[model samples]
Target chain A: MRNILILLSFMFILLSCSKEEKEDLPKDPIILPPYNPTYVDLNDRLPSYLPRMDIPADNKTTIEGIELGRALFYEPLLSGDGTQSCGSCHNQSYGFTDNGKKFSTGIDQVEGNRNSMQIINAGLRTSFFWDGRAATLEDQAFGPVTNPIEMHEKWPRAVAKINDISTYREMGYKAFGVVQLDSVLISKAIAQFERSIISGNSKYDRWKKGEYQMTPQEDYGRKLFNKDRDEIRDSLGNVIQVIPGADCFHCHGDLSDFTDNLFHNNGMDEIFTDPGREKVTGNAYDRGKFKVPTLRNIEHTAPYMHDGRFKTLDEVIDHYSDGLVHSATIDPLMKNVDIGGVRLSLSEKAALKAFLLTLSDPDFLDNPDYSEPPPL
Target chain B: MNMNTVSKITAILMLVTSLALTSCSKEEEMGCWPPLDVPGDSANVIMIFNATTNGQPLELLKNFKDPLGRTMQVELLKFYVSNVFVSFNGASTLLKKAALVILVDPNVTDTTKKHNEIALKIPYGNYDRITFSVGLDVVQNAGDPTKYPSAHPLSINQNTYWDAWGKYKFFMIEGKGDWDGDGTLTNIYGYHTGFDECYRSISFEKMLTLDATNSNETLNVNFEVNDVFFGKDTLDMKLHPSWHGDINTIETAFIISDNFQEGLRLN
Candidate 1:
């Protein structure tokens, strides 16, 4: 009986020590099992002329994150009625824009005034949206999800609904090394997928790489697009032939992405009904200003302008050529504002349009990777 | 406690301490300018720039009279300062590298007014003069912005690079005015100075001293914004409301670049 007591005491001590060890363990140790995701070097896929993307240090790009983000982008459960998704408004065929619609219709059947911007080369932009409202893509993702006229869903409910799905819970764990998903993680995933929608394989890019040659009209249009309104001169300082330049490069000159990523009031109207960038900056000087969008894939991403007023690119060229209206906050780059426009001749306008079409990349429109995934 | 138990607790505490220290290690600071080696007991030098128009603080979007009495309102002003060198009796010491591009924009908000100032550390001494350039050297001017970080001044994100022309705008002055004395400001003018021919080197001869007793010193530099439009030749706003990279206006770009040098004074 004495030996039995001693043996029981030793067993109790061992049990107590083991319990103490268990208590010492972390309360919420990160278990990343089945979460070994492959890191994606986004620069490897980007063009050589483009600069490195400013990816957040906390949210590095990964295959698992992109896949999860793609799913969430197409997930209708994110909306209030489970009838709308981000993919519904931002279709893949029309360069991620609403299909030839002036304004996008929301889940609530309400229409927004601003055109749905294309999602091409979004990773290269410093600011997002027509008014440059969102500073980062992650910040931009938070807007449409909760906007009353857009998705019309509350964040708490949306997060809860996403968390309720076991598939998303598993995907969230694999993508971000956590089982519990939040609005921040969801936005990050969507932004990652958006960053992957690159469009650098356009015909213009091919011509630049010497893989393809542009036609004479396209070549002439390229020269006109780049040339300023200033007159040409000879080496002897003699006045040479004056070329009617289109002057499009001043605002959209970053060839890698085809946008200077700056705001400008391009003299669209004398009095703005919607005060474009003023809402964001609260400055009178910025009243009519709006973000200068990239011209890549401009062929499919029409009608152009923030209002989507023009149905065809020809109307856009005509507006720039002969339809400018002077305003107080018009950009100084619009030097020909007095004449109402740049005044490009008919032939010049045709050539410019032909060159603009070279920016269209069929490969980007048909990429299966950007397509909606099968039901989870 | 028994010896075995005490040893186990000791190991646990050691592991916890190690993990805590590992997580608390300092992170390296990110930027274009890194801390450089300087002599012990170095003096602090601060370069202060005050932008003025007709001896008054220049305000953006406010109507002001030019030399020709034309009502003009300056909207934007930005310039580059590079290759800062301090000289003592013909011997020069480079205070900042050429690759270190410093952008000076007086239009910044009062909270960020320090953006117009530059700070440096040097050995205590009396410098006879200082020399700097208002533009980048040829090689640096045409550099690929993709090679630099986004935070760099020469990076594409800075919005100063003319990617279409493969060059940087050394100086930019954009504004609008009423050339015909109309109540409304109608004429828009922009002068972008760049290219190899437009680069200007400025020399300011002043007795600048940094002593051991007064380890901290400041040098004030003033730029008269009015001189940009009035100095040497009165810029005719009616004939040329804008100057771009066009071959006809290249001379105007050069003239504006020269005027930028004329506007500087050591105070």
Candidate 2:
């Protein structure tokens, strides 16, 4: 009888202790290992001539992040319809530019207004989009996904879809230390991958280092392109002054405007239907002004201009040669505005075209690092 | 205690420790991040720059025969408003006193363009007057285009910062007019003003009271495009076809600069 009493007493005491322990314990008791992402130095990835790019401090680039970003960029799951990814418009072989199309067709089969910008040297750019509408790569990333004419996916739905995928969720955890994927982190990863897309090692870059020799035509063309304004008179009885050179350098940059990553009206139209920079600033002076693309890999990035109006390099050169449009906001750099164009001789135009071809970076177009990743 | 009882107690303690550690680890991941939800001061004043011809909203790229009887279409109209100081009963309090630069572009039809509305965060109080500069101040105006980050309002992409002259255009009003009244825009008149001499500051005695109770207050500010041209001192378009950041343009640029005060009306 005493033994049975002892057993009952022990059981009662154990039950009371367990009840107290339940109240004392926390709501969740799963010890997940702390995620400390590995950071990679971005400066190490870029050439010395180019300054280290400005990325958001919050979204620092990491090895895992870049890999996940590559996967997400190639993943069609993020699209509203499963037919497109960032890789759809941005092809790897064409210097990350869409192939010869003026306007890239969106997932909805509707055409976008402007040309799809090449990702080459994008990390070095101060603004994204030809209009300079978005200030950061991350800001630029959010634009295509939700744009009704583009991917057409609502960000929340996209996030929910991303959360449903175990592969992406694992990537998200490894990259951002978050189990639930957020738009901000996804954008950061994509931007980091994009920043890794660098295009140097062009014929022009090698020419600077004396690794390659240009043909006489290419050399003359380069000289003509670098031509600054010279005070001269032509036979039209109109004295043209103020605009000089082949007059390309001022608008283009030191390597000409392409490398400069600046914007200009470039005298494309007298009255602009599409106000390029003006659309972003609402300034009428910015009407018809579009960001000057780098001349690097220009051969691959044809149909040119913000609208992709010019089909070939010759068309672009011809426009600069004589198709200049006088406008209220036409850049004053075209010093010979009275006569309309630079009046390049036929041979000069051909040479300029030859020089432009030298800017194509084959290695950039073929690099496996920038190629589409395996299916996510 | 028996081995079985000891094992049960050990497991309970382990669970409690694990829960505490999990909680700590989650917080540890987020502890370094800047707080996401700190609110900003209310922006009380919403200034809208509207272009109107005789009380009708000015339509861009249209041939408008203004009250001055010149048949012209405003091809472009853009400027900067900066260094604004609010004037109260006796003293003046500067808003964004150091770095307040706002680019005003009234054209909104373009999908790519930024909207013209400016949301200003004025301090909590009452003010009967306001004062501001017509363009970017000297320091912000005169900088290497590459020196500043792209995100800055002053930093630009080659167009605003002219590479030829290496000068920034403060304000621009470009248009074509039929000076002969022949129904054709033969005369291309533009007043692209810049340089330190052209920067003007104007003040208006308009009653405004900003308090805690009132938020999202809007102020209707009219920018008469005509005031920029035809006033007491007028812009003689014939003498000046265009004045874009040239040393010789200082004389013509000042005439347009002085006219800004007359055009700005606080309704």
Per-model TM against the reference: 0.87, 0.57
Query: What is candidate 2's local distance difference test score?
Result: 0.68
Question: Model 2 chain A: which ten-residue window has the lowest total lDDT?
Answer: A19-28
True contacts kept of each: 0.62, 0.00
Best-matching candidate per DockQ: 1
Clash count list over all predictions:
0, 14
lDDT of 2 by residue, A239-337 (tens): 455432365654454322254565666777877889888878877767788877777788998888888899988999888888887776665455345
Q: Which residue pairs of candidate 1 clash?
A: none
TM-score of chain B of 1: 0.81
Model 1 DockQ, alpha carbons vs. true complex? 0.34
- Where does model 1 exceed 4 Å of error? A1-32, A231-241, B1-40, B98-113
